[model samples]
Structure formats: C-alpha cells, structure tokens
Target: MTFSIVGRCEETGQLGIAISSSSIAVGARCPWVRAGVGVVATQNVTLPALGPQILDLMERAKLGASAALDRALCASEWSEYRQVTVVDAQGRTAFLSGKQALGTYHAVAGKQCVAAGNMLAGTHVIEAMIPAFENAPGHLADRLLAAVHAAIGAGGEAGPVHSAALKIAGEQSWPLVDLRVDWSDDDPIAKLDGLWQAYRPQMQDYVARALNPTAAPRYGVPGDE
Candidate 1:
C-alpha cells in the first residue's frame, strides 16, 4: 500500500512528490517529475512505466495534467488497477483511483497539490494533508514533507510503511531534491526528514557546482580550502 502527494511550488515553479509505502524501494518505482512540466505518482499495482509516459506527454506533447494522464491511462492495459495522481507546473491537478483500488482508498486535490492513498487507515489520512501543504512554510520540499507528516498523524496506511521518498524537480532536468529510505524497521518518515534537513543546507551549493564550478562553494573537506 502507498500514500503520496504530488505538488508544485507556485513561488518557484518547482514540482515534487512525497511518498511512503509498505513496500520496499517505493522511490525507485513511483513518483516522477520533470522540471517546467509536471509530476506523476503511479501506485496501486504500480506500473513504473506509467510515470515516465505521463511526464513525456506533458513535456514533449505539451499536454496539461489531466490530458497527459488521460492519454497515459488509455495507453495502459492495466489502468484499472492503478491509483495515480498528477500536478502540472501551472498547479492543475488530476487523480484516479481505480474500481479495483485496494481497501479504503482516498484521493484529494488542493491549491497546488494532490494527496492520495490506498489501503489507508481512513480517508481522513488523505484529507489532513491538503491544509498541511497549503500552510507549511519554507521550500516546496518542506511543504511536501509537512503534508506527508500530516497524513501520518491522521493515521497513515492500514499497515506500517517500510519505505519513503521525497523528489523535487527544479530548473535543471535533474532533481533538486531526491531522498529515499528504501527500508527501515524504525520510522522511515522520520529518517527521511533527517536526511532532508542534512541536504537542505547544501542543496543550492550542489546545483552551483554543476552549473558553474568556479563559482560554486568549496567542498569544505580537509585540504579543500
């Protein structure tokens, strides 16, 4: 089972997704984002390919969130078993929870975000995330994480979650923030938050290093100065 949020930062035009699941390596399969395009989270009998297909439609075909999703689903032979969510750079959102969706599934859309979960503790788990995302401060990654925390507080999935991921696409083609906890006996969300905190401070520095190495910050390791 999986619970996820696909979001856009109106302030920065960044797209991202935060997700957690009872399955392992949830990051490797679900949650896809393209800078200046959109984000798609494909779960519930997860067809990993559907994620990229949706993104391709949005990026290359210049399709909006709903159109891209519709076309992608039409192409998917196993669409009925999938639960997917999408949010474009313009903040348009769409989602589908199939008739065959797992127990107690729910999906909700908010200002610039969509939260969804299958085999959840209750629909309230999905409901609680919307306000959290709208109100959270700091970066888009922080807001997305806040939504995930709210879902957990509202009683996340019907079962324990073993893996979690946070992905954000900025100006570059690559992810601005990509963090994952593949498997954890302890609290994976908490572990993911810790990783975010550690990465946040150095996020822009890494980007500068890639774009203009001479202007980038120092590595700060021994002898680097």
Candidate 2:
C-alpha cells in the first residue's frame, strides 16, 4: 500500500515527489523525477520502470503529463493494477488509479501538484494533501513535506506505514534531495522529515561543490580542515 504526491514549484521550477507506504523501500520503487522534465510516482502494483518511461515521453517525445501517462500505460501489460501520478515541468498534472487498485483509492489534483494513493484509509487522505501543498510556505520540498504530513493527519494507509521517501530534482541531473527511511517499526514519515531538516542546510553547499568545487565551501569536518 502506498500514497504519494508529485509536484512542481511554479516559482522555482523544482519538481519532487513525497511518498510513504506499508511496504519496505517504497522510495526506491515508487518515486522518480527529472529536474527540468517532470515527476512520477508508480505505486500499487508498482512497475518502477513506468516512472522513467513517462519522463522519457515528456522530455524527449515532447508530450505533456496526460499524454505521456497515456502512452506509458498503453505500453504496459500491468496498467490495470497500477496507481500512478505525474506532474510536468509546467505544472500540468495527471493521475490514474487502475481497476485492480487495492482497497480504498483516490486521487486529487491541485495547482502544480497531484496526490494519489491506493489501499488508503479513505479518500480524505488524498483530499487533505492538496490544500496543504497549495498553502504551505518555503521551498518545494517544504510544501511536499506539508502534503505528506497532512495526508497522514487526515488518515493514512489502511495499515501502518513502515517506509517513506522524499525526492526532489532541481538544476542537476541527480536528485537535489533524496531522503528515505527504508523501514522503521515506528514512524517513518517523522524520521524522513527529520532527515530533510538536517539535510536542508547543507543542500546548497553540496550543489556548489558539484558545480564549482574551487568556489565551494569547506566541509568543516575533521579531515577536511
């Protein structure tokens, strides 16, 4: 069982996906993003490759989120069992809950964002996320965090969630933020959020180190000094 929000920041042009699930390592299998392209979450009976396939359609084939999703599903033999969401660079959104989606499932689309889930407590889980994302402040990552928290507060999955992930794509080819709590007996979402707070301050430093090492700041750790 899984739930996710895929979004694009209109102001910063950042793209990201935040997800949590009863399954372990949900992050590695469900969320995918491209900095200047789009974000995708493939859950339920997850076909992880669908994430990149949708992105390829959006980026190389010049397709929008809806068209890309359609094309991706058209090629999938297991589309009937998948729950997927997409948010394009331009903030256009699309999502699908297949006929075979487990338990309770729903999807909600807001400005520049889409929230979707399968095997959820109820539709309220997704309904609560859109408004939270729309009104939340700070970076795209912050808004995504708000959405994830709101979903949990409203009523999360049908069962306890053991894993969570927050992934964001910015100017770099690699993810600007890729945090995951692969499995936790307690609250994985809270742990994932804590990781975000710890990572946020060093985010820019890491980016600078990659882009221009000569101008980047020192690590300030024992050996780096």
Candidate 3:
C-alpha cells in the first residue's frame, strides 16, 4: 500500500519526491531524484530500477516526462502491477496506474506536481494532496511534505504505513535533502518533518563545503580545527 507526490519547484527548478507506505523501508525502493533532471516515484509492486531508467531518458536521452515514462515502461515485463509518477525539469508531469496496481488506485497530475496512491482509504487521499502542495508556502521540500501530510490526513493506506521518505535534489549530483523513517509505526511523516527542520539550516553549508573547501565554513570537529 503506497501513495506519493513527485514535483518540481517552478521558482527554483528543483525536483523531488515525497512518499509513504504500509510496507517497510518504502524509501529504499520508491522515491528517486536527479538534481537537474527530474523526479520519479515507482510504487505498488515497484520496480526500483524504473526510477533511474526513466531519469536516464530524461537526462541523457533528452526526453520529456511523458515520453520518458513511455520508453521506460515499454521495456518492463511487469508494468501492469506498477504505479508510477514523473515530473520533469521543465515542470511537465505524467503518471500511470497499472490495471493490476492493486486496491483503490488513483492518480492526478497538476501544475508542477503528480500524485498517485494505491490500496488507499479513498480517492480523496490524492485529491487532498495536490491543493495542499499548490497552496502551501515555503520550499519544495516543505510543500512536498505538506502534500504527504495532507494525504495521510485525508486517510492513508488501507492499513498503517510504517515508513516514509523525502528527497530533494538541487545543483549537486546528490540530494540537498534526503530523510527517511525506515520503520516506525508511530508516525514517519512527523519524524521526517523534524529531520528536515534540523537539516534545513545546514543544507547550503554542506553544499558549499563540497563545492569550495576554502570558502566553506569550519566544521568545528577535531580534524576540521
């Protein structure tokens, strides 16, 4: 049982995905981001490799989100069981919910976001997410998390989801923000939100350290001193 939101920040050109599921470690197989390329979320009998495959088409093959998703699914033998969403660097979006995607699957693509859910409480789950993200104020990550929160608030999976993840990519090859609650029955989204708040201030600092050591701020650790 899974639901996700993949989006782009039209203002910043940032792309990322936020997702949660009743399964354990959903983060490991779902959300995927490529700094300047796009974001993808493959769930409901997921093929994790599909994330990179679609991203490859968009990044190197220069395809838009729809065409990229087309090329990736064409090669999949189990496409019927998968639910996927894609958001390109240009903020274009596309998604699919296979005939065999399992219970109560629904999806929608709007402005700069695409949301999908399977084995959900109801259609209202995805419906609630889009407007929250669109109206929420702040960074893409905040909006993304808010979207997931809205989904969960609307009614999450058919059962309890023990894991959640948030991933955002910027100018670097790595994610500017990557947080996960691999297995927590309590509330993974809330935990992820706390992690984001703690890491938010250091995000730019870490990026600066990677790009320019001389100008980067000191770490205050033994070797750093």
- Give the alpha carbon lDDT tens digit for every residue of 60-135 in model 1: 8999999999999998887889999999889999999998999999999999899999999999999999999999
lDDT per residue (tens digit) for residues 1-225 in model 2: 888999999888999999999999999899999989999999998999999999999999999999999999999998989999999999999999999999999999999999999889999999999999999999998999999999999989999999999999999999999999999989999999999999999999999989998888997789775
TM-score, per-candidate, Cα-based = 0.97, 0.98, 0.97
lDDT of 3 at 209: 91
Q: What TM-score should be assigned to candidate 3? A: 0.97
lDDT of 3 by residue, 1-225 (tens): 999999999899999889999899999999999988999999998899999999999999999999999999999898999999999999999999999988998999988999999999999999999998999999999999999999989998889989999999998899998899999979988998999999999999999998999989987899996
Model 3, runs deviating above 4 Å: none
Relative to the true structure, how large is the alpha-carbon lDDT of every model?
0.95, 0.95, 0.93
lDDT of 3 at 17: 88
Candidate 1 error regions (>4 Å): 222-225
